[model samples]
Target: MTEHLTIVDHPLVQHKLTHMREKTTSTAGFRRLLREISNLLAYEVTRELPVTTREIETPMNTMQAPVLDGKKLVLVSILRAGNGLLDGVLELIPSARVGFVGLYRDEETLQPVQYYFKVPQELEDRLVIAVDPMLATGNSSVAAIDLLKKAGATNIRFMCLLAAPEGVARMKEAHPDVPIVTASLDERLNEDGYIVPGLGDAGDRMFGTK
Candidate 1:
């Protein structure tokens, strides 16, 4: 966990995160907050993106300006809930290629089973960011990353709105190289494997469903 987890605790992030956690938050409010928070998280997660210098002329002068270097980025959203975070991150990095992975729990084994997978071409050459709203059991998160790696994604990162200790540990053990960015890491998961004190099912909250 030490090597892989990167908790983003900036003041703006924390402030908005608190709002999203409130029980009284409306669907519209929750969605808006998630978008804002995701943008804040993206800023921190992409801090080290490679930059190259290019000649540019301003109104008064010509000078070398910094631009994103090399390949365009890819954003792989773990379907359903992950789409919430994806909306905000996309707002910030509109040029990034989009991908989707859908995993649902098998009732018998309670393990994640992938139902859909799609990613950008040349994933090996681009920086990839996998977004999800919650890291509860970690099964889906780990499985999603495994799929991404198999598709040739090398430089990868995970972003979530909230996470539990168990999930973080599991992810670190499975993929030590990929760093995780999240707004809050809660105390633990409950008996049913949901993050304690979490704001309920993110997909439900975002979609105004029970």
Candidate 2:
């Protein structure tokens, strides 16, 4: 439950996610809750980022102070719903560089097709975190990672609100080095590839897309 992937079970995260999954939660409420929970999830995902120290003068005296290492991190959103989570995370890591990978599933094929892709420069040098609210089938998530790799990203992490078992296995098989941090790992995906007991379509619920 906590090795290659982490299920964030903090009380705040759980409470917000519970509200988020309710069908009766309004669009504005859903969006607000998503952002709040994202901050909590981002806190856990970035916990092990490498850090360095520099000497600086404090109010009392000069001392070496800890700081995040290297250039600003790169946050790559997986489009549409990803943007909702992205906004919340940015409030926490405001200086991070941002990027987006837009993909939509082919209803017939159930495969991902990328439409837009742009990343910050020097991706390989900066830590990269990809955000998507739902990881149901994992096709789009995996494809997004593939594009990031081609763009020279090496160190990467994935964060989502909920994940299906199938999606987790797919991610583990495709990108074992990239860790996944999610609010919950739900049961199986339904016949149509939706996570069982999922919060409906994340993009629809969050944006009133319908």
Candidate 3:
């Protein structure tokens, strides 16, 4: 399976992303922009969700209304940073089942180590979307997806605010079938495993951490 990656270069997405990259952006402002971008990204991500018809009574007459098909969708957040995107997505997809995978990177090795994992049942039948803000090294993203697949999720998509080429290539090599969606694909990962020209650590900027 070929790995399909989507670049969401919508003008607004790019504009807000620019502000997000600036060092002077306040936490509140950064968060506000992320929420807006995530909502818009959610639109592109769910564009192809299967739909079914349900008969409903309108003000004047009865008509068949298009509704989402099958089981409610699942949104899996990859730990602390993922929560930022998760909150915005939940605002739009309120009915989506939420899950979390806690994976912290070993700074020296740039490898992912799992600490916690929890997800909704019947994942096999749901459209599982894993969310994380920055895909730097891809180890955490790949590890998170591996857990999802083990738990019976067959259809999975990954969404991120920004991605480095290293992370994208890593994900492609590991999971060729899972598609990726992101606002920007940055140049490369620095030796310290951070995206070049990235907005620092997403978890740090978002939560005011060091």
lDDT of 1 by residue, 71-181 (tens): 899999998888999999999999999999999867466579999998989999999999999998899999999999999999999999999999998998899898998
lDDT tens digits by residue: candidate 3, 1-210: 134799999999999999999999999998888888999899888878999999999999999999999999999999989998998899999999999999999999989999999999999999999999999999999999999999999999999999999999999999988999999999999989999988899999988888
TM-scores for every candidate against the unseen true structure = 0.96, 0.97, 0.97
TM-score of 3: 0.97
lDDT of 2 by residue, 2-72 (tens): 36789999999999999988899999999999999999999998998889999999899999999999989
Alpha-carbon lDDT, every model? 0.91, 0.93, 0.93
Better of 1 and 3 by lDDT: 3
lDDT of 1: 0.91
> Which run of 10 residues does model 1 get worst, by summed lDDT?
1-10
The residue ranges of model 1 lying beyond 4 angstroms of the native Cα positions read 1-3
- Per-residue lDDT value at 8 in model 1: 90
Enumerate residue pairs that collide in model 1: none
